[model samples]
Target chain A: MARIVVDPVTRIEGHLRIEATVEDGVITDAYSAGTMVRGFEKILKGRDPRDAWAFTERACGVCTTVHALASVRTVEDALGISVPRNAELIRNLMFCTQMVQDHVVHFYHLHALDWVDVVSCLSADPKETSRIAKSISPWPKTSPAYFAAVQNRLKTFVESGQLGIFANGYWGHPAYKLPAEVNLLAVAHYLEALEWQKELVKIHAIFGGKNPHPNYLVGGVPCSINTEEVGTINTERLNHVGSLINEAITFVEQVYIPDLLAVAPFYLDWASVGGGLPNYLCYGDLPTKSYAEIDSFKFPRGAILDRNLAEVHEVNGRDAEEIKEYVAHSWYRYERGDEAGLHPWDGETEFDYTGPKPPYEQLDVEGKYSWLKTPRWKDHPMEVGPLSRMLVAYASGHTDVQELVNETLGRLDAPVTALFSTLGRTAARGLETKLVVHWMKEFYDALIANVKAGQTRTFNDEKWDPSTWPATAEGVGMTEAPRGALAHWIRISGGKIDNYQLVVPTTWNGSPRDAKGRRSAFEASLIGTPVANIDQPLEILRTIHSFDPCIACAVHLYDPDGKHVHQVNVC
Target chain B: MTRESGTTIIGIGNLLMGDEGVGVHVIRHLERTAPPPPGTEYLDGGTGGLHLLEPLQARTRTVIIDATADGRPPGTVRRLTPRFSSDYPATLTAHDIGLKDLLDAAYILGDPPDVTLFAVSITLPSKLGTELSDPIAAVVPGMAERVLNELD
Candidate 1:
């Protein structure tokens, strides 16, 4: 068996190393290793539970606010504090903004490179590109002159011998199938999207005070709405935010959704590739009414076992019996044994590096192979992320979700089973963006109506002082990040965090084998993938990118003392 | 369209990784102590991959402070004015593709900004901790001063 490894996978956040064993041009087995070991849980020990959000937000650069949200909720859960109505609405807005921003960025910047061949755009006619773009969507920027300018700029950059970030991409790979005109249109929109994303982040900047690590308080939002107060969230600022949301919605409706539909038809065959674990998990998020009401979540939560969309088993993120992280094949020592599964509340973040040293040919797969622990729901290895959330919602009989999923599939003329593959995973993100935009508008309208009604209280300071504390308390803060089910478990004694554990989204999707040696979504998905060329593992990248694996959030900081911590050599 | 006249100083790094957070540390220092030059904009470009391109493109001159693991001694600081995307150093910590691809996108849009990167060299820490190493932490003021001098 020949081994193909993509070390430090490019274009995604953080460092990841994927090694697969190919037999007769097909991947027979795969191992994913999160090369770093971030012991945030260990560091979180003995700290103020109130300060956990700040530290946990640092766990990821892309999804910082999700951690912040989960951290605050964890504290709130421990204190049994319920979020006030306005704060819930505002928090939902923040969550929606992150989802939209992240999904758009993922499509255009991170994952689009996998499908669209940028180099081929050089031969595309600007006029033809403009025509194709206009035919697909009414994006007003579709003038021939604009296309010509974009083409000229690209031509000059190519001739200048500096592709930069585009430098190392597999530009002219055979897997790319988009027509030259379509490719050119995609490239043009890609540039436009860069500016579009800047405007979107302004919403986050307004609500949370900044993007990439917004200021989040434990009990409520940091910003208070005061129309008369200067420099606060007044009418003009809220209007500006509303306008930005409209702009984002317009782009999603016109540019993003159409682009997905236009390009998806060409990649229809990808439906058969990268079908990993059929089991799915989602912790529902975007509460419409209140935090106490789980049924009101815009995206419903449940677990789908063995692709049985017929029945979605209930998944309680807090229940130790339901959600457990297995460390059998991961590089960690469990308190009971290496092969034991532990709930996050009883989780341990101790370090144990047993993999073969770096620059080695392959991981010792039989032994501990990865830093990512296998997180299982109901003892089943599950896939988590857009696909899981989409499938769970689809199975739960949510009418809008069902209509969107069925309608999108019907347009593509794809089977419902197509939802199990890489293209489905990518398309799920687009559909969910539409759903999120709808919910965002709803929440925005609700926020405004609440203001119009003159009920302006955003924070509940009743549980603000930790000094009025329980001697011991433990609680789970679970939410559906843009990724899948994310949970933060915290135990407090005398107001200080006694133990903190996190089961982030990536840890679920990018997990290693469990005690039974069942492959994770990452591993199982690669098992049957056909490799055209070992050197160019474009198929692998496409599948993994669909999941948007954020290894920085999965694994923590690597041990400097470990000889192979940061020196994993790619072959 | 006439371009906006100003320098946008972007501090890019993963602040959780000890010394890798030097860039943000420098920016925070400047925000607290030094008054920025006229028409200067400051941004905390935390490992924010593609989101950074728009800000970089809008400015005429952009100064980025980032930590580098380019085999340099700990606490070493190097300043570079990259004319082309290829002019950037090979190995930047964490969000390399984000910044590199950003420049490429800017180049494709034409009139790529003049980018100056303040790369601080230091060892990456073993475990997840927020505290920066002594040597790297000590150079924060110097890095801030150098970034401020670039404002004019």
Candidate 2:
């Protein structure tokens, strides 16, 4: 038996350390640890509830608006405010736009290199790549000359001896299964996706005044519709948004989905691996009506227990017993004991670093190890994210979700059982992006119709002032972030935040084990995975990146040196 | 919208992490004290990643201000024209995507803008706070002036 530790996993949003104990070429046990500590909950204390969105929005650089959305919704939920229909439609548009754009960026930029071999693309015939690209989709950029140009660029980049970001990748690993022609084609789309994403984010800039950290109001959206005005969302801006939506739909359908389908067949065995937990959770989002109408959510809210698609248990964010967080294997001290669980409303953010100091070799996995607190749904560790959302929607009889899942499964010639693996998680992201791009059109048309009907109200100022107040109130805001289930709980006292807790997606999937010694998604998924070479564990990256781990959102602060501390030890 | 040409001065850092936000602070200072010349724009790129590519490509030149940990004094500032990713300082605050990676992506896509990087040395932050340290805060005006000079 040998223990392989990959510290500071590259190509992820933040620092994550994975330790796997391999026995006879297969992982017998795995431990996932989030090294950074997040202080957002501590920062929000004693501040006005209305201004919390601005601060919490900086939690993660990638999923900028998800935190802000949850923050504003929590404040509004506490204040008992109902925004206008137009504001709802505009928020929906932004939400769906974020989903579509984030998924595309994840698949192409962050997750693609794991499966693609840039060095092998140098050996590919551009004409063969062009032929494969043309046969896959009518994307119009499929000529042999285009493929050749992309290949030339890659050759120059590699031969320059300055691999930069690609420097540390296991390029010629045996785990890479794609053909050279397909690899070249995927490389071309990778560059194209980068350019496409920059243009796609203009929708956020148009409505929310900026991207990265778009402006969000407490009651409703920050932007007001004025078809004739120059500063607000006007006729010209509306047209720009319309065209961008159309372009997004085309890119996802023509480029993203096609690439996903093309690459999935080469690695069908992955469909049987990385199916971690038996339970799944999703706090559904994309409300067709107001947020109160749970039945109207495009992504229905529920939980799947024991991998039973036949039933999806009802999920409640406000119920204290429904969801609770424990710190048995985390660097936190609950006022009640480490073994006891506390709901978010009664959550605490005290830090107790009992693990090894920095620059240390191994972590005391038996003791407290990770920065992420273990969150259990009704005392059961549940997997969250795209797979959970898709499974819930499928079990709920959501027509569009069912159709997409069945169609993709049919194309791959796989069974419904395959929906529980890493491939399913990745394919679900692309399929949902397909559904969301079309929803963007629906939202845009709805906003236009409301404008034409002379209903231009975007903010409700009734609860804007703190004078109209209650003594103390507690509220929970739940939404489906691009990663998975996200909820922010707030307790307002004397118009100030008394306590605030955020249970993000990564905390559910990438967290350590609970008091029962059962593993969460990240650790459990790697238990049975095979490692071809202990020195270069490319297979581990394939399964982990499938979750699109966002540790910056999961764990917060960094090493005091601000330097990336990397280490790979084989013992 | 018509594409604006000329220089774009972009400041990249996390505003929540004390001196780590020197770039954003310098951008704000320049915006207030010295206005841009004609088509030059000021952008507060919070912990910049690939998103900086489009803005960089839209302009003919770009001036980036960021905090670096290069074993120098806290307030020391230096400027360089980095042609490749390896030229960037080893440590740029905690960001999902590093500046070097973003520059590399721009180079691969072709037509990378002429970039001038201004790096300020600082001790990496251990806690979260919005206010910059005294030493780093004292140099903000000087960094802004240098960026303005580069623009001119």
Candidate 3:
């Protein structure tokens, strides 16, 4: 078996090292590692539980609001307070907006280059590109002149011999399947998506008070609603937000979703690739009605074991009996021994650098291999992300989710089982975006009605003060981040944070082996993937990027002072 | 298409890491002490990557402030307008937004803004805490003054 390592995998957030063992071109075994350690949870101890959002949100700048939302929700959950209905709708809207923006960015920018070759676009005829683009959706930027200008810009850039971020790409690799014209079209949208995303973040800034790290209060959202006062959610700003959502919806329907459907047919073979652990988990988010009512959640919380859509077992993230994290093959120490799986409330964060030193050819896979601890749902390495959420929703008989999933599979002429592969995972993201766009309208309409009915209340002041709290209280804040199921566990004692742990989406998907030697979702998915070239393992990148790995969020880290522990490892 | 043309001074780094947030410190100093040329945008770019493209694109010139650990003494600052990927420092702790990769993407796309980098030298901080250490904190005022002079 030839070992191939892609350290510091690019085009995704944070630091990731993927190594696979290949035999006769097909991967036989794979190992995934998160190089960075984020000790944010450790820092939270002894601090006021209210300030947890500020620190936890910094764990990932890209997915900032989710951590903040999760942090605040956990504190509120511990305090046993349900937020006002208006606050719930606003939060749902912010999250859904994040989902739309994030998924689009992931597809066109991060994952698309893996499939569509930018270099090949140089040969594309601008006229043909424009025609094909117009045929897919009426986005109105399809003039031949516009395509020619884009083509000229690309040509000039390529001729300059300075490929910038486009540098180091496996441009002409044999894996590239899109035609020149199609590639040019994708490249055009790729550029357009940059502008599209900038507009979407405005929604976050309007409600949450900033883009990267929005200001979130524990009791409720911080945004005020006074038409007569400045810096409030007034009629003009509300209408602006409404218009922005409309624009985002139009782009997703016309540009993003159609683009995926258009590009998907060329790579149908990917539907069978990268099918890892069939166990899936989703903490249902985006409540359709009220946060007080669990059944009103649009996403639906559940776990699917052994790919059995027929039997989706319920998952209670708060119950330590259901969810636990094991550090057996990770770079951490547990008082109960490395093999012991501990619940998040009892999660440890002691750093023990026991692996082989840097500049090594391969990891000590037999021992500690990754910084990410294996988080098991009932001792099962469950996959969490778009695929898991979609399947769970489908099994739960969410008719809208079922229709979208069924229609897409039918159009592809693929079986329902096909939903388990890399292509299905990518397609699921697009389908989920469509659902979110529809829901964005629903939530916005509800918000407007709430305003008209004079229910301008947004914050729940009942739990604003911590003096009323019990001596000890603990709660789990669970939700479906754009990536997957994310939960934050917090225990407050004497009105301060005592213990905090986060089982982020990437932690579940990119985990190391447990005591049972079970491979992570990332490792398991790569096992059967064929490596066309050891040097250019684009197949591995495609499968991994499809899951949208965010190692920065996965591994809880904090850079220690006065000590440079790592001698930077470059790929 | 070309972006809206202007100048934006963006500071990029992780504030959670003490010395690593020197760029933001420099920007904060500028915000407090000296004002920029009219129409010049000043932004807090916290460890951004591709998102920097929005600011980098459609601009006449962009200046970035970031902390760098290149075996130099803490508090040492250097100014250089990087023209190529090779011109950038070998490593930037900003995991998502590698300065080298961001510049390369723009240059490859044929619309790279003139980039001036204020690379402040500092040791890599391992632990998690808020305050910038001695040497780094002492240089913040000087770095801010230098940025203002560049604006002129």
Using TM-score as the measure, the top candidate is 2
Model 2 lDDT, residue B119, Cα: 86
Give the number of the best model, judged by DockQ: 2
The reply for model 2, stretches above 4 Å from the true place, is A557-571, B1-3
Better of 1 and 2 by DockQ: 2
Residue B61 alpha-carbon offset, candidate 3, angstroms: 5.4
> What's the TM for chain B in candidate 1?
0.90
lDDT per residue for candidate 3 within A1-571, as digits (tens), equals 6778787677777778888888888989888998767666777899999899988877776778888888989988899988888899899988998899889989987899998999999899999998898888988899989888888887887787766656547899998999999999999888788767877787887998765567898888999887667789999889988999999889999999889999999999999999999899998888877665667899988989998888878888678788999988888998888878888988888877788866577788888888888999988999999999999999998999999999989988999988899998999999999999889999999999989888998887886777788999998888888889898999999999999999899999998888898887999999899988887888989999999988777763232211222112223
Q: Candidate 2 lDDT, tens digit per residue, A436-466?
A: 8998899899889889999899999998889
How many clashes (backbone atoms < 3 Å, residues ≥3 apart in a chain or on different chains) does model 3 have?
Answer: 17
Tens digit of lDDT per residue, candidate 1, span A6-61?
87677777667788888878888888888767666877899999899988887777
State which docking tier applies to candidate 2. Answer: acceptable
DockQ of each: 0.45, 0.47, 0.34
Which residue pairs in candidate 2 have backbone atoms (N, alpha carbon, C) closer than 3 angstroms, thus clashing?
A37-A557
Which candidate model has the greater TM-score, 2 or 3?
Answer: 2
Which pairs clash inside model 1? A37-A556, A37-A557, A38-A556, A38-A557, A560-B126
The complex in candidate 1 yields a DockQ of: 0.45
i-RMS, every candidate?
4.6, 2.6, 4.9
Whole-model lDDT per candidate:
0.82, 0.86, 0.82
lDDT of 3 at A277: 91
